[model samples]
Target: MDVSGTRATDENTRPPAVIKATARQLLVKVGAGGLSPEAVAGDSGLAVAEVEAVFPHRDDLLTALVIDAYNESAAAMERADEAARAAGASAGGRLLAVTRALRKWSFDNSGEFTLIYGSPVPGYHAPQETVPPASRTPAVLAGIVRSALENGELTPPRRAVPGPPLLRPEAVELFGGLPPAPFSDVIERGIVLWSSLIGLLVFQVFSRTHDSVRDESAYFDFAVAVAAEGIGLVVPLDDGAHTT
Candidate 1:
């Protein structure tokens, strides 16, 4: 099961226990500034040469960690969604629950969130082949939008109305009735919220601003509130009502 060895099984076929353990340990110690392969090898009790043999470079380890963090976030969101559904909440309620879960995840994993969103490491090209299917944040946000529309939470633009509203879609089910806005807009706004939250934490983390702000939990709560406000604007509560 140790992948950092010669003649190892295909990565896809390897058990995740070893990799996950190593990654978890590294992340706990090194908050997403990224870790060297040598560091990971020492922590994992594997030989430095063997770590290089498997990961080849620091980028591989970072890419793996990013993918892992995203998967964990998505799973958490899914659980929140399921809980909301069980409570007989509408799709809009479920979407908000998922969004809140994501915000909480970001705050909890600030290091991982910063690495994935704040900045990309130099010379670290993500291996397209190794990227997870559900790790794309934009696509996930788009799915939430579609769900809100279907749940009668958002309104499509009305054609018969004048100007911009007239040009918008009239209903959620009708593709043509959907707004002309691109998916990128939603993704960008989400990233902005995430980055803003991280920036606030980074300032506090590095002692760059507000020397008096010693309570990390208080700052995190403020950041979450800001992120929630951004989501409210991007998704808009009135869309569903407008459509109805």
Candidate 2:
């Protein structure tokens, strides 16, 4: 009846579930400073060989966890976006939605978020050698810029700056009334804005500052206002730019 073949097939199919559950357990232990494969295997009542059969290596587990966390966060962000849009939110409103969503994700999934965002996982380098565009904070700023461009918030196109060395046609179209500067300038500003948002979130999540002065929603509003100002969007008065 080829029972051996049937057993092998079943084991192969079941290993993935065992591996995922084992990884989840290990992630929980990671915060307690006990996140070794051996520890996880011992805790899960699985042999080291069985654990490795699923995860292959420690980094593989971490990478899988990171990817899983990212997918969860992204899903939450999409739902937040939908909710904001349904409530007739403007770009500023969407910015708040995404910011709050990210903050909540970090707070709720501290271990997973810390592993991915706070420190690099061993042996598992990002394959692209670049951050995911959607995950990049600059991409969020760029989104605001794009929205502003579409809404006719930026001044009309006219050559204002001094030099004209090289430029992308898309860049030219977006930075209205701005000179033919390098695209790097725009990219740099976006990166700066992105960094600001991330830095604020990290600070708030980690509780680096005193609780009396910490208001995540207010900080988020300020960040959005600053980003909007950088991209020439009409700054909303109620965005908490002047608040702490």
Candidate 3:
């Protein structure tokens, strides 16, 4: 999975495995700002021209790092979701698990997280190549919502209590160019829940709490519960039984 989803195997498109592996190691140490083809080559004991052939510019190297970060984080979320499913967790539980996985990923790879989600580097406009890789995590969240919808556990928004309004373009793109069925009307709420999940991580990762929040874990659980409900996920009962 070279992020392009093409026929380019590890033997062809990118540099050698050691080069990329060593580059990531250096990325962790130096952060995105300090990253350079020459620097990576110097540390990896490989020729700079060899690295340049694979990554001609600084932005190319940055793009690779960004793709790697997104893939890793998305994999964490998907793996956690699978684990939750294996343990007989409901859709809501799976949502919580994936949310927890994302937060944990941010903490574990703080530098990488900041590299993509933090302040944009000047003049570094991500090319179209970044879109699919960037969509991976959101696709996982959408899957949780879709599962709940398919199981009839998600409640549709009522006319009177309409959950915000999504503009035409975004709604259409929310689900593979087709607005979410069954829960189509609540796409705006879904958008809020999705963005808010990331916002919560930004706050926690940047220590925006100023040390006031005694238990971030509890707070995260609370937020996940809210997001679950926001997307209309039915909660299981006290006896660990689903009422859906």
Query: Whole-model Cα lDDT per candidate?
Result: 0.53, 0.57, 0.72
Q: Give the TM-score of candidate 3.
A: 0.79
Error at 79, model 1, angstroms: 2.2
Model 2 ranges off by over 4 Å: 1-34, 122-124, 129-141, 154-186, 211-216, 234-244
TM-score-superior candidate, 2 or 3: 3
Listed in order, each prediction's TM-score against the native is: 0.57, 0.67, 0.79
lDDT of 2 by residue, 16-127 (tens): 5555555565665565244556876787677889877766666556555656666666667667777876887676666666666777787777776676666565445644
lDDT of 3 by residue, 103-210 (tens): 889888887788878888677887877877788888888787767777776876654234544456744465545435556655566667889888888888889864
Worst 10 residues of 2 by lDDT: 1-10
TM-score (C-alpha) between model 2 and the true structure: 0.67
The most accurate candidate by TM-score is: 3
Residue 151 Cα positional deviation in candidate 1, in Å, after optimal superposition: 3.6
Candidate 1 vs. true structure, TM-score: 0.57
Q: How are the candidates ranked when ordered by TM-score, highest leading? A: 3, 2, 1
Single out the weakest 10-residue window by summed lDDT for candidate 3.
1-10
